[model samples]
Structures are given as C-alpha cells and as structure tokens.
Target: MPSSRPRCSAGSSSWSTAAATPTSSARIAVSIERSRPEAVAALALDAYGLSARERQIAALLLAGLSTQDIAARLYLSPHTVRDHVKTVFAKTGVRSRPALTAALRPI
Candidate 1:
C-alpha cells in the first residue's frame, strides 16, 4: 500500500517530509538552524574589546560557572578569575554577573 503522507517539495521550509517506502509507514525529518555561541561571543568580544583571557572567563561565566569553577577549568586561582570577572563587568558596563550576562546574551 502507498503512504498517505503529504509529499514535501525541495523548496519547502526547514521541516520537510518524504515517503520512506511504498508502505503505510512514513518518516518526517526536520532541519533546524541554530546560531553559534562562538559567533555571538566573538561579536561581543569585538564590541566590548575584551581580552582573550577576559573572553574565556566571560564564556565560562555565561555558561553558569562560578569563580572557583571557572578557575578550576582554566587552572587558575579563584582570585585571578574573580579579577577577570570584575574587569569584564567594568568593560561591559555591567555591575554584576547577571547584568553582564543580560547585556551580552545573544538575541
């Protein structure tokens, strides 16, 4: 038996469906376009003039890492990470982590 599912054209949007076989069963495939986080971070870095270390710290901060966590990941002292966080806040004109995150978060 032939499947009753609708056939999707090549010009269709991200989501499209096609007949799998000459049977009642059909499979649907969906294509999703996602913005790269690195691209967003690069833009932010350029806009804010953040140093390489600062950008690294900012990325970790946005990922919900604490000072100690970020330091541990980077093999740095917690104090050093805290200093970078402070610099990031100052350069971004944000007073706190949440504010920095909100200011730099990708749309």
Candidate 2:
C-alpha cells in the first residue's frame, strides 16, 4: 500500500512563521477592546451563571487573554483571576477552559 502523507519541506518554517503572525480575523477575535460588550454580558447571563465580575473575567478568557492579562486589565491579581475561573468552572460544570470553549463555540 502507498502512503498518502506529504513530506515537510525545509522551507515550511518561513511559511509557518508568516502565517503565525496575527491577522485581521485573529485581531478581531482577540480584540479585548472591540468584542461586543453586550454579547459578553449576555453570555454570562445565559451560559455560566457568573457574577458581573466573573462574567467580565470569562469574557477576557474567552477572548484568549491569559490570567496575567486579565488581572492587569481588570486591576486584579492573577490569584483572583484564577479564583474567578474556578467559580466559573463550578457554575458552568466544566472542568477546564477547553470545555468552556466547546460550550461557547455554538454561540
């Protein structure tokens, strides 16, 4: 039987590096500054049963921010961000952010 896999070329890294840079879609998706504010609010209301603060944190997480970024943006500590994440996990009954991601995907 013949294998159908393609070989990786030595020049792939340059292509990968170019593609890895953030583009307009990624910029839009990750725009902590530009994502719809009401949508985040509504996601909190419908999905996770989070408090206002927790919802804010969840919005940042869903927007691909790290805990450190969330903390810095919200003027909270990383520990507090982590705690909010824990509460979000508890309320949503999800064990991890990947699960949260999956739950939020359809919306």
Can you tell me which runs of candidate 1 are displaced by over 4 Å?
1-34
Instruction: Compose the digit string of candidate 2's lDDT tens values, residues 1-107.
Output: 22222222234221111112345564422212222434434544455567889778777777789999999999998999999999987887889888876565434
**TM-score of every candidate relative to the true structure:** 0.63, 0.58
Report lDDT (Cα) of residue 76, candidate 1: 100
lDDT of each: 0.71, 0.63
For every model in order, what is the number of clashing pairs? 0, 0
Q: What is the TM-score of candidate 2?
A: 0.58
Candidate 2: residue 5 lDDT (0-100)? 23
